[model samples]
Target: MSLQKALLLCSKDAGRFILGTRPIPRPGAGQVLVKNIAVALNPADFYIQKLAIFVDEYDFPAVAGCDGAGTIADLGEGVRGWRVGDKILYQSHWNPDTAAFQEHTLVDAVRIAKIPPNVTCEQACTLPLALATAAIGMYADYAQPPGSRSGGAALTEPWAEGGRGKYAGQPTLVIGGSSSVGQLAIQLAKLSGFDPIITTASKHNFDYCRAAGATHCIDYHATAYEQLPAAVAAITDKPLGFVYNAIALSKESQDAAWAILAPNGTLAVTAPPLVGKANDVAEDGKRVAWMSASVHVGPHQDMAKRMYGALTGMIERGDIQPNNVELVHGGLAGIPDALSCLEEGKISGVKLVARIADTP
Candidate 1:
């Protein structure tokens, strides 16, 4: 067996280190061997390292990373829907042998999506994880009609289509419009018919957030939380209906969010909110939905597949543009440096994508 280079984490607190020679994995049943070309880093990568969330200590020398864009080099038995040379992108929570950080990967066929012709490998790498999270969070309760699997694909049933009476034309707020998930959530909210898609971001990102479909951009740092209630009220005193808090939810921010919401409106939070009693409930008995999404979660397979299809369709049609990405140049060596920058929160408004290979 040929050896491949991979970034490995030997322990929960391990800093990324390179393994010069690890056996390249063969594609298992329902899997495809991909030559990875690009990998995108997310906060969870460092958080998992810092917090040591994985259960198996014996599973040391773990490969880290969740999102990548690559090409199918070979397919395993029983795998369909993909062929060698097909360019694709995927996000998975499985172990490092199948992880995105390796030069080669064995990915489950179900988790992969063909990269549209218009998207670059770097651009495609950024979408899977963030889009998957957004789609799942926004459409958790949605289900497609029976007999809808056509062309070996699953159909999507957006929450709006289900006639969820609470969200229609509701004043929805995206707490952090500039974050990758926040950017996608803003667009999804607009697509789902949320009126006055409100968001809170720094003034620097105001224009970009608006371009992505935010109807109102409140400067969260510069402006007081009290101002949000009045601004939301000015638009329509109907109460803020769905607030997607994509930022670090503090008690203050959560309380402010709850204050502006109408009775029974829903609040969806993405980040770990500041644990406080006030952050637990909306003022009007609205539902506070905390989104705990990770690519590793098994139950999201169907949702992930459906979302990749729809998001790919949207990208192909030019409906949603890729996030502003800064492609890192150091290849495998760049992983540690890029990760350090990410941990410091120095990277803002642009995602850092590392090229793992020269080709798709």
Candidate 2:
């Protein structure tokens, strides 16, 4: 008759979102129970609710949020190398018991990193999904057919042996450099020693992107997407060998990125391919890989393990840094309004974070 209770945000009915109580879930084998301290917002959290994206039935009572940082409440059977009360950061899915919009959730041990001593929970929460998107886009093995638009760029992961500075002197660009995923890509590119890293962002975020290691920042607002090639040309006479299109939210952005990609280079995007059809790259070796960004799924799982295993070291050593955080008030109750800002594109250069305990 004993059960621990947790609070969660979900669609109580059609178009009705509310916070309600559910039994605190127990971790299964290879899973850990996490008491979420902070949860970071993502664009998908808004689109899934407002547009019914990524869900077929428009199901009610489904939770949102894909990233979080928290403490391990308990460990499940056969789980090793982790103990209760260990602070960790991990990604989550949309399921009610696993999502980050709740006070507690279940996490796979293989897909988590211990929160580094130097980072806060809010900072740690901003990383999981964004880091995964960038890392999987760059380092995970590519699709079998090559340029199939379903895998990563297949570059060597920075965590692998001799991976450090492997791309020394290579030039790269990251579109939407101020975006969460873009910032992580810039940082990772720095770790691999990409010289003269170029990126696109508004002028205000130029320094933000630069802090992440971008040597050049093009103001897309002023330059326009069509002129990216010229803008990039002005920054570096070097060939654009690799482009990370972190802002593939629209075809214009994708097209702009596509225009600048060099032959034999790879274009890695956060969403599905638009200008990157397999046939589109058949004649030339210009490649496109749309990332899945899920550490729990097929093809990405092995790399996820390796990446997560090294994540703590990467953070402690300053090889990877968290994104900027903008706290939204009212915690769970406040997410709807906070999401409105994200949906309206009002939020920029910072990740929106909510403290779960602040829920009333």
Candidate 3:
């Protein structure tokens, strides 16, 4: 086994991170070994560090990271449609060998997507987790039992038969439109034929949001959450049945979104359901779908496979775009500071990324 540099959370009891070494893992069947070039930070990385939420299931010195973009160093037995040296972006799992903080990681080939010529490794790194969060929240099938739903609007996916332009003239809302996931939601909503795609963001990010396909960008700082319903009403008379709240950590945003949703509508949230009960239905027939964005996980797997299959062409054709990148210096060493920035709410629309191979 070969050693690789990794960032380790030494123990569940510790609140700090340290650099360490781990064995470079070989890809299993249907998997690929990627030499990570860029890895993006997310809020979940901060929470996992502070709380040790998933540590109990792991061995000591757990590795934590979820978004990575790199070049294929080797392919597993029986893998197809990819070759060594191909640039790819993928979502990481909970285990150490598959995590993104390491210099090299193994990913299921089916869950990874090729990076188009237009996108850089830093830009592609920002897409996997955020895009998965948005796509799974908006398109996955609705479970038979509402409580068992895998957290999507169950909308017709634009990649499926007759899915493109399926919701023509429909209106949709995306709270926090300038955020990574929110930006993807706006674009995906546009592909589904939604019109009047309204979103909320800081005034400075209005142009950024519009560029991602949002028809209107509401200045969240200027308009209070309680005033959102009337503000949306002023835009269009269409029934508001769909909402993707990318910044659902804010109770006020969640409440505002729920208030604006029409009867029997779905509100997909990135955070756990804070505005409503996960297993319970609301009185007005509105339902909250809590997003669990992992391509390698349960119910979401099939949908993600289809999405990944189409991702290359989507980028090649300009249907999908990567988020702006703010590169962190010092490679893996700079990750802690980036995670802190995320924790302190300092990072806004742009994603923070690090080049793992540049680790010192």
Candidate 4:
């Protein structure tokens, strides 16, 4: 077995991350081995480490990372149309052999997007986890238990036939528009021909949101979460049909989003739906859907593959753009501190990525 460097979480809750070695994994059936060049840090990495949430969910000493961009090193049996040295960006699951914290990992071929010539490895690395979160929330279809919020918004995906520009002239709201997922939501909304795409962000990120196709930008600092509904109301009278709450970390934001949603509209969130029984449909036809955003997950596979299949062309045509990138020094070792930056709310409007080659 060949060895590779990895960042290890020796235990749950309080384990220090150790720079260690693991075997370079081989691709299995329908999988491909990628030699990772860059990996992006996400908020989940912090929560899992600080809260010990999914530690027992996978084998330890855990290797934690979800977003990666790299070149294919090998192909599994039955895999075609891809070969060694193909530039690809992909999302990985919690499986130790496939996690992104190492130089090499196996991924199902369907989960990857070829990196177009215009996109760099760092920018490509930011797309997997965050983009999936937004795309799955807004577009993926799945069944949910009655009154449960474990599914997607079930809207028409822009990648599907007639999905592009399907919502023309309608208004859409993306809370926390400067967030990684929020940025992608704004782009996807634009791709679907949504008009007057409104989003809330710091005044500083107003242009940032606009670059991603947000037509109207609200400063969250000036307008508090409690005031968000009215702020959105002032932007467009066309019934607000879709609201993607990318920063669904609080009850206040969730409630404000619910208030802005049309009776028949869908409120999609990154966290559990907790805005005043908002997940349950009453006399009103309003709905709330929370994204579990893993492309490898059973419910997300159909839509995930559709999006991934179209991703290369989207990038080439300039329909989708990468989030702002902030480079973190020290490669895999730098990820722990980068995760801390995420936990402290220090990073905004940009994805923090570390080049695997920078590990020292």
Alpha-carbon lDDT, every model = 0.70, 0.84, 0.88, 0.87
Residues 1-360, model 3: lDDT tens digits: 789899988878646878889899888999999999999998878878988875558886888889999999999999999999999999998688888988999999998999998888999989999989999888876542345745687899999999998988989999999998998999899999999999999999999999999999899888999999999999999998998899898888889999899999999998888777653567888888876787787778889899999998998898989888998888998899889888898988899999886689
Please give, for residues 244-352, the per-residue lDDT of candidate 1 as tens digits. 7777447777777767756756555565444322124434566555554554454456666666666667778755666788877677667767778998979877788
Cα shift from native, residue 183, model 3 (Å)? 0.9
Model 2 per-residue lDDT tens digits across residues 1-360: 224333333443325456676667889999999998999999988776775554434345677789999999999898999999999999997666787888888999988999988999999999999999999888876673354445777788888998889999988999999999999999999988899899999999999999999998888889888888888888778777788999897998888888888888888988777885632454578878888787887768888899999999999988899999999898877888898899899988999999987888
Q: Whose lDDT is greatest here?
A: 3
* Model 1: CA > 4 A from native: 14-16, 55-58, 142-168, 273-284, 358-360
| Cα RMSD to the true fold for all candidates | 5.5, 2.3, 1.5, 1.5
For the record, the alpha-carbon RMSD of candidate 2 to the native fold, in angstroms, is 2.3
lDDT of 3 at 218: 91
* Superposition-based RMSD of candidate 1 using all C-alpha atoms, in angstroms: 5.5
Predictions ranked by TM-score, top down?
4, 3, 2, 1
Show the lowest summed lDDT stretch of 10 residues, model 2.
1-10
Runs of candidate 4 with Cα error greater than 4 angstroms are 142-148, 276-279
> What is the per-residue lDDT of model 4 for residues 1-360, given as tens digits with 9 covering 90 to 100?
789999988888678788899999888999999999999888888776776665568888888888999999999999989989999999988788888889998999987999999999999999888889998888865344444456767789998899999999999999989999999999999999999999999988999999999999998888998888788778888888889999998989888988888987888989877864435564688878787778887667877888899999998898989989999989998988888888899987899999999999
Report clashes for each candidate as comma-separated counts: 0, 0, 0, 0
Q: Which of candidates 1 and 4 is the stronger one according to TM-score?
A: 4
